[model samples]
Target: MSQTAGVKPMAIAGRAVSERERCLGMTDAERAWRKQWLKDQVLASNEPVHVEELWRERTNPIRRFYRAPLDKIFSGLSGVLGAERAATYRYITGKLGLLALGILGIHYYFKYNGNDWTKKGGWRVLKSKPLVLPGQEGFPYKSDRKQPSDYAERGFKKAAI
Candidate 1:
């Protein structure tokens, strides 16, 4: 009477027909018959099909299993070098290490040698005058920002000479 009820019967019938079709399609005799039909269609001659010969002629076994010699060489080298050496080599070759080393060397040289522009002596030179900067008042080095008065007392001007 209702549309929903009318649709239920059609749905049930459709499911039953699909199930019947699936069962019919799955029978061993049906499979055998289909195989025989396919074999008949594919193989015209009565002689046995040489699947291996066909595969060999059509597909390359060497290409399927082929590997580049360099890949093997690198893998072997990795095994020989061990993890530490490989990681070290990778790090040393990277830009970060070089940049870091350059920064560190510059910092060390500047810290010890002192910048030429500032006229502030190196650590050894600072021992006598103790080069004090503008902002640094109590601190010894002219570079110290805390001692602002010492820089003024030392007549330290910010202008580049």
Candidate 2:
């Protein structure tokens, strides 16, 4: 004759229904009500709560798969190397992993493309030279002759004197 709160105990052929069966038998309205009730409880507690924490089934499967192995590795490292050294190893390994990935990407990119960028004029094939002829205006140099500017003449003339 005992019953739990929020659950309506149903007798099927004079036997009590299991928790999973009771949950499965709930309608859409019941599910929605339960969700709202949980939300209300969270609000009343005034504590930070995630949607995943609210529902056990809402965990990311991919994250879960990677987490176990990573946790094991981290714990093993911590035990062997101590916490500080373990953190350093994690940081170094992460950077090395990223570098390796970058190197592999660059290797594949160059292998597939092979001088196609130069062919497409993305880069110069030869060293560039000044387009102007010697006699033309806007030429590069006047024979590298250092002509004294007005400021240099004024400053240096007095200094030399």
Candidate 3:
């Protein structure tokens, strides 16, 4: 008896068939039909399957670095101190401190070693008596002149008397 004949003929009609025959004993035509049926079943299942090649290619080494034990420990330490406070302290104690010190050093160096401001032409120009333009008031040199007071009629005591 033939292998297909001895086995009861599978009902290809609508029936909940749980068991499946292995493709090894199936003829070329039977195998092709089975493949198409399996493909249709998978498409109808509405489940997602990851493509192995794409998944392998997309995995990142940097993600591993972030997940490393030492990195996690350091991140926890910074979190405990508060991220903003830790960052500010790091800046002040690191390059920012050096930059501030360098600026102060430059200012002091110029202050002590540089030419005096009074000796410069700009300072001399500023210090000299301002030139009075036409129709402009000149500096009053009279020390004995008393200023007119609005409070004089208001019963305020006059210091001059």
Candidate 4:
């Protein structure tokens, strides 16, 4: 004799025992849930379509009832970022990229041409009027990089004539 002849299979109330319940061995609560789900699917499919214009018109009160709220919500949530804001951010980022590229070009130019450090020597000073003072002595203007004290330390001195 087989195991089915020895023991009995579980049934869902008055309904036939499902093959799923026999295979996976579901409890009474699970079988009740499965029966309710099947009944819900059958009732949902049996819903009647009641269009008043026979077959010529498809728009009905049931569709518009659900669409109005969805349309309002969609219109309110769409375009969170408008075209103007998107273009503004794009333009700012593009200018930043060009600025960075220009800086890199300057860096490479200085790196290649940095070694030509010879100063083209001549009387390159700007010929201008001397600084007027209380006496005949004139105060010479010096650039920030050059100091007369440095030249004096090198044994070069200017005598007042």
TM-score of each: 0.21, 0.32, 0.22, 0.25
What lDDT is reached at residue 88 by model 4?
A: 60
Worst 10 residues of 1 by lDDT: 9-18
What lDDT tens digits, residue by residue, belong to model 2 across residues 1-161? 34556688764322113466655577777667666655655544535544755554756778567555555687688988997788787767767877999999887776655443224423222334457777788776343325645322322434533
State each model's CA lDDT, in order: 0.56, 0.58, 0.55, 0.54
The superposed Cα distance between candidate 4 and the true structure at residue 78, in angstroms, equals: 11
Worst 10 residues of 2 by lDDT: 116-125
Q: Residue 143 of model 1: what lDDT? A: 49
Give the per-residue lDDT of model 4 (tens digit) for 44-121: 543566464773365677866755554454445446646456456555655686799999988876555443214333
Indicate the TM-score of model 3. Answer: 0.22
Q: Best candidate per TM-score, number? A: 2
- Order the candidates by lDDT, highest first: 2, 1, 3, 4
Off by over 4 Å in 2: 1-71, 115-161
lDDT of 1 by residue, 14-119 (tens): 3223556756555676566656655655655645654867766866767434423433544466677875575565555555656988999988886767544445
Off by over 4 Å in 4: 1-80, 115-138, 141-161
The alpha-carbon RMSD values of the candidates against the true structure, listed in the order shown, are 19.5, 19.4, 25.1, 26.3
Ranking by TM-score: 2, 4, 3, 1
Better of 2 and 3 by TM-score: 2
The top-ranked prediction according to lDDT is 2
Candidate 4's error at 31, in angstroms?
A: 77
